[model samples]
Target: MNIIETSQLTKYYGKNRGIINVNLKITEGEVFGFIGPNGAGKSTTIRTLLNFIHPTSGIAKIFGMDCTKESESIKKEIGYLPAEINYYDDMTVSDLLEYSSKFYEGDFDARTKELCNIFEVEKNKKIEELSSGNKKKTALVQALLHRPKLLILDEPTNGLDPLMQQKFFEVLKNENKNGTTIFFSSHILSEVQKMCSKVAIIREGKILKIETIDNLRASNYKKVTVEFDSAEMADEYKAEGMTSKKTRGSQAYFLYRGPVEKLVASLYRVKIKNLNIQEPELEEIFMHYYAKEEE
Candidate 1:
């Protein structure tokens, strides 16, 4: 089932384009990644879906219900963790959590306790007193406490330390195992690469591509670094897929995406001190997409 779907979903802020003719379909029980740098319409798209803002022209649906018209009913099944959170400053963590729980139907005490324990959130601390990391932790706990069917997270790990980030991911994995569909949005490629099965790349208010993580990783790009005994030898070797080239002294660095045998055969002529060939990271692969668009 498609948990979420959008068709020609466009949003505008006066003359500024937020998202133009954007389309997306996310299946139930899948971890979907929405990735782009800041000011790339990721947040705008999300906000429109949540009915926090209206789309200028287009249709968005959650569970097959119109987003704008059925948002009140839709929100009951969603747990959202915005990129920035602002709880009542004077309230303790526990108090804020308890207040949030009242809107939902079931008891959240046990789940809240479990989440707090996992995140090590200090429930006694006032919202104003907690550090950024701790505030993030609180927000995460609140989102998961409802045990909602879908989780919409925007830059969810912004302030977490490494250990806490790991713990949070583990929690997400567990939730996915239990059939919670997650919509994870962030510019951090590594984290998305680690957790999501499929990802959609968006830039400049447009979605460039959507593919499974494995397919994306296997999509032809290779990171190659070559070192030469002489600068002349390094300069002589070239291939069709070679791009983003860089030269420093006697070493050359670039990306290659064609047959490895052809590259090796070409490299045989060069007097090289060392050679390294490996798959490029998601960030590099992402840049390749943008580069293609610019051309």
Candidate 2:
């Protein structure tokens, strides 16, 4: 089942573009990654879906319910973590969590306690006294307390330490295993690469690509570096898929996306000293898409 669907969903903030012609269909029990650079409209899309903001045109639905009309009902099944979190500063962590639980109908006390323990959050500390990391942990605890069917996370790991980040991902994985759908939005490509099965890359308020992690990795681009006996030998070499070529004395390095055999044959024409070839990182692959879009 598609737990979330949007078609040509456009949003504009005054004269500035937020997102245009955006479409996504995320299935149940999947961890979908929404990735982009800063100011790429990742937050805009999430806010629109949650009905925190209105769309200019098109449709958005969660569990087949209209986003604007049924948001209250839809929210009952969603656990959301915004990019930035704010709360009453004077309240103790225990008091804040207790207050948050009153909005939901479930008995989340046990789960809340478990989450606080896992995150190492001090219950007695006032919100004003907690560190940024602790505040984030408190926010995460609230979001997961209800055990909602869907999780909408925007830059969720911003204040987390590396160890905490790993632990959080482990928790998310367990939630997915239990059939909770997750929409993970972040600029951190490596984390998305590690956590998501499928990813949507957005830029300048538009989605440029939606691809599986495996297919994205198999996108043919190869990082190739070759060392020659002389700059003269390096200057004479050229082959298909060689782009952004650079030379540093006796070394020539470039990105390739064509047949390896052809690249090898071209190397035979040069007096080679050493050679290295490896897969391009997700960042490089993302830039390739942006380059293609610019073209």
Candidate 3:
């Protein structure tokens, strides 16, 4: 069963469009990445999914549970970490977690202690005393202690140190292996590429594309750059959909589908030193969507 599904899920704020016709589906036990540039409505879509705000039109379902009607029940089985977390500064870490546990009916003491130990969080310290990263970790502990079936994270690694971030990813990986569905939102392509199997690219409050990472790469999309032996051979190559072409001595660079036969054939006569194939960065691919979307 699809763990989450949305069809034309749209939302608006006053006259400002938040998201429009956002069609997204996340399969069970899969990590889906929500990618978009800043102010592109990533958070709005998430809020609509969580029913924190009602949609302007369209539908959303979490594990077949209606987003509008069953949000209370839906939240019980979902762990969510928003981009920003605020806490009562006077409360100790232990008190803060204990207080938040009242929302969900669960025995989180064991899990809470374990998480604190693993994350190296100080239980006795007041919330005001912790570093920004530590405070963020406290929020994470609350979100995960419920042991929900689905996890929704927005920019989860923002306040985390590199070491803690890696450790946290390991925890998420373990959760995924245990059959949890994860929907992670972030603009960091490298981490999304590493952690998510499927992804949706959104821009200007609209979803531009959704596909498996493998399928995206298999679209015969590549960047080909060739280096030539003779300085004069650089002029022989041509490119298609070629955004840029540069020549330096015998070395030439072009951005297009690889195995540039026409360009290579022209350079074959003089000196062909080496050829390099560079994969398009996710941001570049995302920009392609943006350009198409704008048009």
Candidate 4:
């Protein structure tokens, strides 16, 4: 079953635009990444799907129920973590999660305790007393405690430490392995590249690209830099149909989009003293996309 379906799903803020003509479908059990920079309308799209705000036009459906028409029902199966969170400051972490559990209609004690242990959150601390990372961890536990079918995580790793972030991803991966559909929004490109099987790159409220991880890997472009014995040997680093060269010190470097072996052979021809290979990160690829779009 399609876990989420949106067609021309548009949202506006008075005269301001949010997302326009967004058509997307998410399949069951897919760990999908919604990749974009800050203020590219990623949050706006998430809010519309959660029915926290109404769309100016178009439609959004989750589990076959229209977001605007049946948000109450659809929310029952959704586990959402907002990019920003605010709660009763006076409440203890234990009290806060316990209070939230009331809305999900289940005894979340076991899950809550287990999550607290895993996330290293102190249940005795007041919500206001906790650090940002701790508060974020609390929200994650609350979102998962209900065992919802779909996990809609918006900037879910916002306040985690490096160790905690790894732990959270591990937990999410396990969830996906067990049939939970994950639609995560993130500015962390490396995280998305590592975790998501499928990714959609959105910018200026438009989804510019969507592809499987394997496809993106295949499309990976490497920047091959070789330090030759002398600048006189720099020409040997050049390959057919390859352009864009930069020289610093004794190194002749150029970008490579073909097999790694070709670049290695070209370097060997130059009697390279040393070599460096840098792969284009998703952030680099995304910047290339937007930069070209503007042109």
lDDT of 2 by residue, 43-150 (tens): 999999999999999999999999999999999989998788898988999999999888889788899999998888899999999888888999999899999999
Off by over 4 Å in 4: 223-229, 233-236, 239-243, 259-276, 279-283, 290-295
Candidate 3 is scored at a TM of: 0.82
lDDT of 4 by residue, 41-143 (tens): 8999999999889998889999988999999999988899988878799899989888888998777789888988998889999998888888899899988
TM-scores for the candidates: 0.87, 0.85, 0.82, 0.88
Ranking of all candidate structures by their lDDT, best first: 1, 2, 4, 3
Model 2 residue runs over 4 Å out of place are 220-243, 250-252, 256-284, 293-295
Where does model 1 exceed 4 Å of error? 220-233, 236-244, 258-287, 290-295
Give the range of the ten consecutive residues with the poorest summed lDDT in model 3: 258-267
- Which of 2 and 3 is the better model by lDDT? 2
Clash pairs, candidate 2, are none
Name the candidate that leads on TM-score: 4
Tally clashes: model 1.
Answer: 0
Q: Which ten residues in a row have the lowest lDDT in candidate 4?
A: 234-243
Task: List the global CA lDDT of all models.
Answer: 0.91, 0.90, 0.85, 0.85
Q: What is the lDDT of residue 203 in candidate 4?
A: 80
User: How well does candidate 2 score on lDDT at residue 117?
Assistant: 87
User: Compared with the true structure, what per-residue lDDT tens digits does model 3 show for residues 109-201?
Assistant: 899888888788898999988888998898888888888899999999999999999989998998899999999999877678779999898
